[model samples]
Target: MSFRLTELAEADLECIAAYTAKQWGEAQALTYTGQLTHAFRKLGGTPSMPGSRKRDDLAEGCRILAVEKHLIVYRHHAGLTEILRILHQRMDLLLQRLF
Candidate 1:
């Protein structure tokens, strides 16, 4: 299966990088970004892996997978997965309207 990042997901990544850089440092930001990219590849390779959890509130096929302190939200379909957002684990997903 193939995976793609939605525009919002891409924007989320950018914002994450910027925030991490400001709060921590450039190196940490780059490291987290790299981790996120690796997580995306893993999701593409095995989207139904055990650790990923279903999100019924989001939609029929929505799911969330964790990578360290962050969460990767995505929707899976026939031949591809669409990454919807990347958010900090502590953030209230409901307040963000992730559902």
Candidate 2:
């Protein structure tokens, strides 16, 4: 399966990189972003694998994967994985109105 990030997810990643870089450093930001990228690829290849939680409550076929302090919200369908959002663990997901 192939994966793509929604505009919101892309924006979230950009914000994450900027925040991480400001609080830590450029190297740490790169490292964290790399980890997120790796996770996206892994999930795209094996979206239903263990360690990812089913989130049908949010949407049909929805799934959530936690990496570090971030939560990746996605769905796999028609041989494609669509990343819906990348939110901080502390964020209130319901308030975000995640699709």
Task: Assess the local accuracy of residue 18 in candidate 2 as a C-alpha lDDT between 0 and 100.
Answer: 98
lDDT by residue (tens digit), candidate 1, 7-54: 889989999999999999999999999999988888888888889999
Q: How many clashes does each candidate structure show, in the order listed?
A: 0, 0
Residue 29 accuracy (lDDT) in model 1 = 96
**TM-score of every candidate:** 0.88, 0.95
lDDT of 2: 0.92
Using TM-score, give the best candidate's number: 2
Query: What is the model-wide C-alpha lDDT for candidate 1?
Result: 0.87
Q: Using lDDT, give the best candidate's number.
A: 2
Each model's C-alpha lDDT? 0.87, 0.92
Poorest lDDT segment (10 consecutive residues) of candidate 1: 90-99
10 residues in a row with least lDDT, candidate 2: 90-99
| All models, RMSD in angstroms | 1.7, 1.0
Query: 36-65, model 2: which lDDT tens digit per residue?
Result: 999999999999878999988777788999
